[model samples]
Target chain A: MSTGAAEAAWQPSELELSRRSVRRRASTRSVVIALISTVVFAGVIGLALVGSPGWAVVQQTFFNLEIGIESFPAILAGLWVNIQVLVVAAIGVAVFGTLLAVLRSLRGPVFFPLRALATGYTDLFRGMPLLIVLYLVGFGIPVLDIFPRLPAVVWGTIAIILTYSAYVAEVLRAGMEAVHPSQRMAARSLGLTHAQTLRIVVIPQGIRKVVPALMNDFVSMQKDVGLISVLGAVDAVRAAQIEVAQSFNFTPYVVAGLLFVAISWPMIRLTDWASARLAAREQSGGVV
Target chain B: MTVLEVRGVRKRFGDHDVLQGVDLELDAHEVVVLIGASGSGKSTLLRTINLLERVDDGQILLGGDDITDPGVDADRVRARIGVVFQHFNLFPHLRIIDNVTLAARRVHGMPKDTAHARGLELLGSLGLGAKALDYPDRLSGGQQQRVAIVRAIMTDPELLLLDEITSALDPQLIGEVLDLVRQLKSTGSTILMATHEMSFAREVADRVVFMQGGRIVESGPPEQLFDAPVEPATAEFLARVRHH
Candidate 1:
């Protein structure tokens, strides 16, 4: 078709074409505005960083690259701890949260009470500040003589599980409910029991459907583990804090932030890759 | 002896009575087709047989065993009776073969290898063997419905209940799924299908039952029921459906 004929066929009216063009222009303009704003904001932040004494100290401390090599073992250990905390907490949250979600979704006389209880648990933990929860678990529990002998690491782990389970449960519940009711009915008609169907079919599909959300959860959880350092957990942040005290300088905190960025940056990229792969799989009607 | 029986089956959804003391029976290897207008309790009756939807007051028997007994294991009863839903209801997460084999493995305790082989054989018979590894979303409506049949039969059930299995298919696709059902009849599997397909009812069914307002209005051999329906309601229903 000729360009004029094709354009006419595609849009059909001058009004529609004008409206489309207006929207396209508006979107492009907004994108340009956002880019400019971001550049300005980033430049200001860079100037502030350059003017700070911490930057000079950071430069001086890392002036000998061999110092980094010597401290590699400590840094590696801290990184491993971060990973371990994330994986253990993630697994706990996924399993417990799924069970709670399933229990919340069950019907009949038991549904309301179970739902209310699950809701209460989720809301209570999720609504509280994570740092407060960590403090309460790590300090208040001992004062209250409730598991007084429990270590700070144990308290921190509990705090992480409690706070994140609520969030993860909601994500998983949304994923579970996204599956069509027809799928569940099909499972029932096929004579698979409810538990068997969930284990073999529903949860697997739900988990796949919520991969990106789960990855986001893990990424955030990794950052939140740093919060536990305030309770004397020897995480990367706590180690950096110790270094800052010894050097009487703030450079270690920046190094710690970089360390965190190093951990979360790959996870964010993984989330993007996983999200795209999931979208592709959904388009192809299979798991990628 | 009747392979299936539903007697005094009454179902209520809160205050509304869905099935008001309905009664029906199916004999071994005989295809009994239920013909009805909308709200005639056909689908409800079929669902109650498998206890997917429980009846408020009723007794359903399968092979002389009272399935609705107070202490009876409902799952065990359901496992012995196969049902094909109108929407096909293929589990989208599973492959076509897995959809079929799941019941055999879960309900019947059949070994994975045996269930897989039997499921594949059933799929092959239904001309869906090549698509066994493909997910349900990859198949056409008719192919999915056929795989539904294969899934239902995987437990080697004594009776099969089909709820308007072809109603959701395109007109062109309806024949293919029905043809699969027609092929199934020759295998000597007892079937009780709820449908509005007059030609299929007339040609394939041993008995035709006409229902209206949640009751069986008339029933007879397909020829007698279709050619000379006894009740005026039956005649009117047939005429109305045929007109549409």
Candidate 2:
């Protein structure tokens, strides 16, 4: 670290330093301009909002600081339940969807029944609304007295798996089918069997192609985990409901909504970033 | 001796006939270049020869065996032929040397060490030895195509089908791949190639076959065909290609 004088490459030339300084100054100026514009626009909107006639009543009901603070602990605790359900449901959807995709991908007249069944399952579940599935599974399973009366959270997780797996399976199948027939020919020409070709060559490439689409589904799933609160699960939304009832104010609901935005916004941005990166990678191949 | 004979080969995709009763032949150590517009069925003809596309009606004789016969094993027939595609079609995930050796080792049962030795030697000769451990995408487009040529030939198939191998390359990169093909030709590998490069065909090909509407319109020595094309379609195609 002390050998700076010996390190000839460490010094940039005067002209180079001047060029870099101009670029840096331009960047700093743009940052200042952007900050000024954003603050001015936000200030205008804030003044308009506060200047409205209903501000006093609206603020007392929806923006009560005391109620929001009091309900934060319960809402955070309930989010832990959503996280557990999300983890289990994500694994379930991946395993079940892949199996269904494999079943659908089987060739020959002999496996027509399996293909038809897998196709029918994806069509049926993808068509059904997630809320209705939750209601039916949440209510119907308990009525059947299945396995000593499972909790609503368990049933909600199951319902999510049933619905989301259909989406995942379809995405995966599209990926597999989109793998060019030429690639198969290339593999088979090397004397690989149809099954061996799919395993070794086709499936891996297929999964790679649809990774961006798969990440979109993952981001969507994070938002829908909030819906589990409807099935009498003490998840964030339900916890907010209990808090709002006790306080007789809308601030608790606002807290829950903001918490969800905070949790899922970064993932939504991440999916967008990944999609752009994948498109770039496809165009110019390097580390995929 | 005839290495390949295509007799009355016809292939149809839906309502459009891709190959309309075509016949051609190639001898040992000979180079036949197919030149035509994009949809003239030269690529489809190559695919049918390698058994990637089934012929609607025809006979293809590879070394006196009727390969187009329904009972013939397609994979076995394909293994006996080498193909270099326009897009370089290299397996992106595999290292350059692995791509070269995979088919030779898997289908021909060549031992790993033997295949690797040959692979490295061939790559080294082509100026790709230092890149042996890198994946296909890491190399330039021209280099990847050279690697593909290596993959196609390292197995030493009886016949080689090059389907528009340089069409997908950049203008500057095209020469690198063409040079490799020229090198392959000097080594006496029998090749049936499809290309848009008229000059390369004139220089390397024993015969140039011109096609129009899935039919071979004319065929002769490159000098006879390119300089004194008998068919109007052939002359017009040549004029258009030269204008470009």
Candidate 3:
């Protein structure tokens, strides 16, 4: 496989060579353009901020490296709380939300009450702000004294589940409805019971179809878990609040915010990957 | 012995009477074909028998059991019959093997190994043994319809209902499906099918039923129905089908 022998064996035509060169030039030009645009945008924003009159105060309060470093341990530990709440609430939301969706989608007169209740639950929770639900459940439940006093963290986690399950249920219902009616007809014609048809045929496909939307909701849920901090639970944001109160600096808040972004970035990428895979599968006519 | 009996089956979708006082019967080992124009109630009649559509009036009996009675369990009644539809109704998420084995395993409570073996046997007989592991989307439309037929027959129900099974197929593919149906007819399986393929009706049907305006206008042996139809509507419909 000498170089000259290989070149002779596989000689490129003039048209092919020109086309290759053109493609190469276009790619290189686009890369250069992208780089220049990025540099200009970043430099302009950086210069404007540095040239501003309040830069010194803003930098000292928000970007102090020492304060950020000091806050890391507490914020990281508090982030563990957010993680626990997120994982538990995610599981709870999936189960409760699917149940609500099933109830809402039931047909005939026998399930009318259950359907109404599910509709009311979704409407009431989805209409109210997550923070208000947090306030009501976090403060209101313990005061009622009907149940034993649970930790504020537990109450906060409940609030997140309550609000998110409503949205997740709606997403699940939409996915289930999107399954063609022919599927149900086929299942029933095969002698599968209504329950069996839903379990064995419909729900599995429906859930797969909604995976991207569910992942999107889960990512938002990771952030909403931070809202639990308003209940005095020591989640990352609450820890940052404590640090800011003690030091009179906002750098800890910035650190906590960055940590939240760090946590959600992987999930966002995961959702993008899942959606792309789904699109590709559909285009190729592959099974879900 | 009669395998299925439909007595005065009536169905209405809003104001339109889709099946108006339809009465039909199928004897064991008989292959009956229903032919009609679009919206002529062929599908609605089959659907009513399968319990996919509730009849507004009349009783449907399967092997002397009044299946359309309000107290009757639809699921249990459906288990005793097999049905294929106009579209390929294979479950998309499942492999061909699983799709075939599902009703046998779940409804009949057949063992998994038994179902798998039976599914493989059916697929192998149909020249689809290698595709059992593949999902429905991987197969051609004709293959998918064949799998649907296999799935329907897995439980060996008392009767099989096919609703325009070969209509969705390409012209080249229709023969393979029709061949499978013909093979089933030879096996003494009782079938009541609705189809637009007049040639198939001529070949496989022991009795050819003609429907128009949601009513059975005429029915007889294929020779009488196709070559010597007594009813003007039947002759006109067959003439139109032949013109196309």
For lDDT, the strongest prediction is 3
lDDT at position A179, candidate 1: 79
TM-score for candidate 3, residues paired by index: 0.95
lDDT digits (tens) for residues A53-111 of candidate 2:
99999999999999999999999999889888989999999999888888899999999
Cα error, residue A192 of model 2, in Å, equals 4.8
lDDT of 3: 0.94
lDDT by residue for model 1 over B25-118, one digit each (tens)?
8889999999998788898888888888887997898999998887887767777888898998877777888888888877788999998998
Q: Write the per-residue lDDT of candidate 3 for residues B58-143, one digit (tens) a residue.
A: 99999999988899989998989999988988999999999999999999999999999999999999999999999999999899
The candidate scoring highest on DockQ is 3
User: Which scores higher on DockQ, 1 or 2?
Assistant: 1
**What are the runs in model 3 whose C-alpha is more than 4 Å off?**
A1-21, A284-288
Interface RMSD of 2: 1.5
lDDT of 2 by residue, B118-188 (tens): 99999999999999999988999899989989998988888999999888889999999999999989999
How would you encode candidate 3's per-residue C-alpha lDDT over A19-74 as one tens digit per residue?
A: 99999999999999999999999999999999999999999999999999999999
Model 1 lDDT tens row, A90-198: 7888778888777766667747888889888888988999999999888887788756486677778888998898888888888888877777776776667777767
Best-first order by lDDT: 3, 2, 1
Compared to the true structure, candidate 1 yields what TM-score?
Answer: 0.84
